[model samples]
Target: MTTPTLYGYYRSSASWRVRIALAWKGIEYDLKPIDLVKLEQKTEEYRKLVPTQKVPAFVTKDGKILSQSQAIMEYLEEAYPERPMFPKGLYQKAEVREICQIIACDIHPIQNLGVLIRVAGSDLEKRAEWARTSITLGFKGLEGRLEACSEKYCVGNSITMADFFLASIVGNAKRWEVDMSEFPIITRINNTLSTLPEFQSADPFHQPDCPEELRKN
Candidate 1:
């Protein structure tokens, strides 16, 4: 099968989520970089590809365009079942999805690029505080759930959708200088996941378009 194509901005947390998912599944895809900082996503050509004007849009080899990271990850799981990211059993799968949603729905949307931009006009510091607060609250809840479900990864001993979601959001939190030490479980899982080649390879800092000035040495 021909490789799929992914359009994304390097620092976008949503885009980062999809990148980690793709790598974990061992899927090959072409990366098309979009400069969100430059407002490149507003152009007509890009709009045609992503109606929501979001990054991380996927175009299949069959020429279908897909938006949303969760949807793309689900499609990847369904399309390529060899290296599965979801748990095998029914109850385990539900747990995995629940953990994944804690980040995807509860945490990510409120702290996304669009939300941040919208808050820019308001008191910038206050907006950042809001983002940090939301993130911390989410992490606290996830920490409790993870304590019960996690072994090595977020759910069970294997890397699943939960790990991918946590990795992506933790990267975002680090950028904002939110201390993960407050949530030891999350900190441990995040540190462990970061060491894996799949997670490291999918890191925003490792992306081709990543800004050198913003990179952590």
Candidate 2:
């Protein structure tokens, strides 16, 4: 089978989640970095691949175009169920998806690149505040929900889609300086998940377009 193409920027949390899923599932893909800072996403060429011209768009080997990180993740889960993102049991699967939605819908969209750049305008401080407020509100509820099932991972002992979402969100939180020390459960879970090779390999800083000087170990 031919490898799919994943178009995304390194710093994009949405893109990062898809990367984690792909890596964990062991799917080989080609990266087509859509450098947002360079305004490459707005070009006519990129727009043709994705109507929304958004980062993290996936082109399947059969030439199908998939957009939206959460949708793409779910598609991959169903298509490539070998490394299943959800555990057995109906209720448990719903719980995992609930957590993923909390991050993807509630927290991520409000503070995403487009929204932040649009609302922040020229005010750097406001941008940080936007990120902090959005993440805090989302995390507070998420922390409560996670406490019931979280062990080494979000849903249970095994890694699920929730972990991928949480890891990506936490990465963005730290970058935005959200002071996540308050969410001990989130911090703890993220700390554990980050040490894994799948997580580490999908890290934003390790991607090709990540600036050399700005890269972190």
Candidate 3:
């Protein structure tokens, strides 16, 4: 079988979500870095692979292509079920997906690269403010939701798909300098989850394409 390939940018929260899932599943695949900063994803070549011109595109070993971080992660869960990313109970599964969508749909899009560029142009301060505002507001609701379901992880004691989204978004929140003190639940969960080998290995700072200056040894 051919090796599966993952096209993603190191700092992309969407890309980071898929990376964490792949790592947790112990999936072996090739990684192709798409430089979002330089508009690499918008190029004609990459566009053919993903018409949306987004990162975190996955090409399966059988040549099936999947886009959108949540969709790709769901596919991984079904295709490789040994290490489940979801809960077995119907309601529990829905709860996990709810947290993922809150981060992916309601929160992430407001501060992603494309939106940030369109809204703030080249103004770094504007971009940071835009991202910060979205994250701060999103975290308020997210923290409340977690207060009802969380234990050691976002949904329960076990690490599910929600933890992946939580860990990835918290990184973005810190990047924009969002105050973590206000959302103690989110901060606690993220701090606990970040230490796992899967999360650590899939971290943006450790990706091959991360800049030398930005890379963590």
Question: Which candidate model has the greater lDDT, 2 or 3?
Answer: 3
The candidates, ranked best first by TM-score, are 3, 2, 1
Pairs in clash, predicted candidate 3: none
Show where candidate 3 strays beyond 4 Å: none
Give the per-residue Cα lDDT of candidate 1 at 199: 88
lDDT (CA) per prediction: 0.87, 0.92, 0.94
Taking all chains together, the TM-score of candidate 3 against the true structure is 0.98
- Off by more than 4 A, model 1: 215-217
Candidate 3 Cα deviation (angstroms), residue 212: 0.6
Distance from true location, Cα of 22 in model 2, Å: 0.9
Identify the superior model by lDDT, candidate 1 or candidate 2: 2
Give the clashing residue pairs of candidate 2, or none: none
Clash count list over all predictions: 0, 0, 0
Of candidates 2 and 1, the better by TM-score: 2
Per residue, candidate 1 scores C-alpha lDDT tens digits across 81-155 of 877889898999999999889998999888876787787655778778878988988888889998899998888
lDDT of 2 by residue, 61-129 (tens): 787999999899999988898999999989999999999999989899989878888999869899999
